[model samples]
Target: MTDPAYQRLGLPVTASPFAVLRAAVRALHPDTRAVRGFRAARKRFYRQMLCAHAARQAAGDRLTG
Candidate 1:
């Protein structure tokens, strides 16, 4: 079966999920002045996105079931 996580991000099965998530974070926060700051923001943004995605998925499942 296809991974829901990959589908959620609209990435191909062969793509790295971490890379997809990193690109998303970069798109959201595009003005980083330093590597450390970018890394920190990326981590925080990724966590937030993942949590939001999971919540939406769970809610959809609940509605459909």
Candidate 2:
């Protein structure tokens, strides 16, 4: 299954945790710096992205909580 989270981040399902965090940070940057309240929004968005990624990972038979 292809994940939109990975698609949006231009990454792969096999991407490591470090890679996911880095890509998310990169995507959130600049906007977070220039816009007011953007940091909070970015954090919220990143959480959803991570949750989606986790769901995809779990689909591969790796259990997560």
TM-scores of the candidates are: 0.52, 0.64
* lDDT tens readout by residue for model 2, 1-65: 55565578976677777787788878765757578767787777777777777777777665543
For all candidates in order, the CA lDDT equals 0.56, 0.72
The number of the candidate with the highest lDDT is 2
Ten contiguous residues minimizing lDDT sum, candidate 1: 5-14
Q: Write the per-residue lDDT of candidate 1 for residues 7-53, one digit (tens) a residue.
A: 45664333444666664655563456346647876677677655555
TM-score of 1: 0.52
The list of candidate 2 runs beyond 4 A from truth reads: 1-5, 62-65
lDDT of 2 at 23: 88
RMSD for all candidates, in order, please: 7.4, 4.1
